[model samples]
Target: MNFDLNTEQKMLKDSARNFFSREADKEFIREMENDEKGYSQKMWKKMARLGWMGLLVPEKYNGEEMGFLDMTVLLEEMGYACLPGPFFSTAVLSVITLLESANEKQKKRLLPKIADGSQIITLGWIEESGTYSGKGISAKAELKDDNYIISGTKLFVPDANTADKIIVAARTDNSPEDPDEGISLFVVDLKGDLKGDLKGDTNNKSINIEALKTIRSDKLCEVTFKNTIVPKDNMLGEPGKGWETLNKVLLKAAVAKCAEMSGGAKRVLEMVVEYAKMRHQFGRPIGSFQAIQTGAAC
Candidate 1:
């Protein structure tokens, strides 16, 4: 099989490269690193207009209906520019989970908003243990009448500070033969706007979000839930069987991240080559030196 990018993929790569290079320059990236939200609302809306936000969602939900490979092509450019925001969390993590698990009603209600950039969602899975295994999930969700009262702290949640909703992985069963058997996924509304017949007292008061100090200033947060009530209808997939879906989401996210890192590495290599060519040593360009050439080649 051929490994070269197809014509459409090549065009997408070129467009994304040009867009990032022109919009997310070095100065803009530096500014965002110190900004409170770690991204610009203006630029985000621009991306939505360009249909980047809905690259993976189906056209029925007002999305471009692009596939995963197409998304990676765009993500690589984003990584090269060091673009910061909730794009990965919302587009790659939350959207994939919803597509793989959410029923028709839930998708109709949520996916459109996500596609239009009006809603921002994130996944809250990692705990203080910092492990991705099922045993690492300690947050508990207890079913009470028509609701599930969830209590747990999620560490290093990306963009939780600005998220409208968070899809949390909580343990619904205290004890099971297998650690991954009893976990459930719940959609926690941070803005108090519960949709459909699932309306309840869900609000920001039940949640506490503290932005962590990351070296890259990536808007990561420590989100704590204090008796947060999520409607039963908000749970994605069957109860006590969310680990499978979560695991799938993680795998896809990992691949997407690798693609982004590849782009970043490519940019770094280009910078190194340019520097070597320009910097002079012993009255000659260092890049022309045999040692420098060998090192760069290796």
Candidate 2:
């Protein structure tokens, strides 16, 4: 019945807005867009210090233990400012997936690093098919020597150039009956490069990362895996059940994305209204015209 944000939520929103206005202005954004990593380490550290990087991680891992709605509010502000980097991938994808499926050891070792911003991770699901659902997950993870050998490519991977780890989707089982049956998830160590050719994981095979330019200039990359090896312990969830875990993460991700878009859309409306008020046509402010008022109303 209550639609209003509580006092704490309102304060949180205002704090985020103030931070973005002061630290992520257009000039800073443009500068970062031109930078190699497409993100500022200083800013990332500041976010970690502000307890944002750990918004979703549990208190046991030194996280703030915030709920989904709280993180969604922050995401909205991030979108309004068009915040760059792997905030979504690290905070949402890696954190949520680990929480959903990882065992206690995995949680203890990795979740702390993520919560403190010591490591940046990404999720690679889409391939050349360009699908977000389960069907597009055709990357193979053949079992070999107490480990899995991954061979395939992922397209439109976010911020691969900067991530320390990547939780990749691969097909572990070869059942032709159900397309989604064979799918599984693995956390691949990138060692801080787009070329995920890990020394321990790879059998002298090279992984690849190719940058793709988007209209917004976000860091998108096409990642190729050629006989990449991963330890059996890297498995995120039960074998042949990764989609089940990812499905839940996908739903949360959807909500977070929708909230962010809503904020961005609101920002657009404010910009339009300001332009209408400042720009005069035919000796009157455009905002004074009924047509402009109608546009603003909508």
Candidate 3:
């Protein structure tokens, strides 16, 4: 297969690069890093209008229906700029998960909002123990009549403060004989019933959100749910299929993270090269030295 980017992909790459150069300047990124909301509404709207948010979505669902390669190219640019926003959480996490596991109804109802930037979604999967392997899940969703009465806590939920929806993983079948066989995924209205103070979900009683800081400081938070009620229809896929979904998302997230780190390393190397050229030692530029040249290569 041809690995080269076509004309359209090249245009997007150039356009996104220029956009980042102007809009996501260092100062702007620093400001966003310190803010409670790690993203900008204006930027989000701009991206939405540009159809970047719909890059991975299907055409039938009001998306651009782009492939993963295009998304990865844009992600590299975002990483290079250190763009302060929830693109990964919303696009890579929420949208990807929904596309992978959600039913037709959920996709039809939710994907449009996501594409238009009217709604933000995040995955709520962590607990107080902070184990990402889906362990110690006190969060339970019992089948009552038709709705699932969910009760428990999810901590360190990324971007919970501003998310409109939360894709939650809960224990639907509590069989002590097999703890790992009952997990399920649910798309809940985090902003409505799961909100709480401390930068958490919007509901105070049902779901509480507490904003946390990462090394990058891009609006990561912890959310806790207490006796929250979720509808059974909100469930994604069949019950007890949560682990499979989590594994898929986790792999994608890891790949994105590795791409981000690679971008950072490239930037650092470029910066060092620029500095070495300007800084002269002895009689010539520092870059003339074998050590510096070798270091730059490495």
Candidate 4:
């Protein structure tokens, strides 16, 4: 495989870096952290206008149809800027899962909304078990009259409160013997619920969002789903295929998280290098000391 990025990819990376550096500055990120939604509508709009929201979507859906390699570059820049948003939850996780499992009409209906930044979506896959195993789905979806009623609690659902839509995983009809089998994906309109929850924030004035505390300020919230009803057409793909779809979404999210961590590491290195140049002791730059140099290398 060609390891080198082509001209177009390099340009994309450079452009994204510039955008993040300028728009997603420290003050901007700090403000987002305090905001209930933990993100800026202006920034989201800008990203949508720039097509960053559609990085993984198909061309027919107004997305660039770019591969994960390009997305990795963009996410790295976001990490470097300490951007606080649902980019990973909505764009990477939810969108990728839907694209992989949803039918044609589903794609046509949802993808464009996501692409235009009019809708923010997230996947509700984790349950009270507090596991990412993807096999322990206790949520049930009972079909009745062209609709399915979902019941269960999902813990640590990333950005659930701010999402316009939720792609949830529920058991349609499967036994305990079937690990990840018998689970299906469903899309639910959280427009009303999400709005009701965040009721008085600026811009998203009707939404109630709470950011859980963690080393990473971008924290996931614990979500409880009542007997939520979803349309039958919202079921993604065939029954018992949620595991496959979720696996794809998680892998992509993993790559995105790794990129973010790598960016943070690089930023640390840059800070160390700057300190080594300016920080001094005993009439000499600390960087000139052998032990300090060795420590930095290590």
Best by lDDT: 1
Please identify model 2 stretches exceeding 4 Å from their true place: 192-205
Of candidates 3 and 2, the better by TM-score: 2
Q: lDDT for model 3, please.
A: 0.81
Tens-digit lDDT string for candidate 1 (99-133): 99999988998898888998889999999889998
Worst 10 residues of 3 by lDDT: 194-203
**Poorest 10 consecutive residues by lDDT, candidate 1:** 194-203
- lDDT per prediction? 0.89, 0.86, 0.81, 0.79
C-alpha lDDT (0 to 100) for residue 218 of candidate 2: 86
lDDT of 1 at 84: 87
- How many backbone collisions does model 3 have? 12
Which pairs clash inside model 4? 197-207, 197-208, 198-206, 198-207, 198-208, 199-206, 199-207, 200-205
Candidate 4 segments whose C-alpha is farther than 4 A from its true place: 174-176, 193-211
Q: If the candidates were sorted by their lDDT against the true structure, best first, what order would they fall in?
A: 1, 2, 3, 4
In terms of lDDT, model 4 sits at 0.79
* TM-score, per-candidate, Cα-based: 0.96, 0.94, 0.91, 0.90
Per-residue lDDT tens digits for candidate 3, residues 135-211, read: 56658888887677788777778788888878888998777455556889988786664333112333436777778
Superior candidate under lDDT, 3 versus 4: 3
Candidate 2 residues 27-145, lDDT tens each?
A: 99998888779998888988888888899999999999988889988999998998889899999988999999999888887888888888898999989889777787889999998
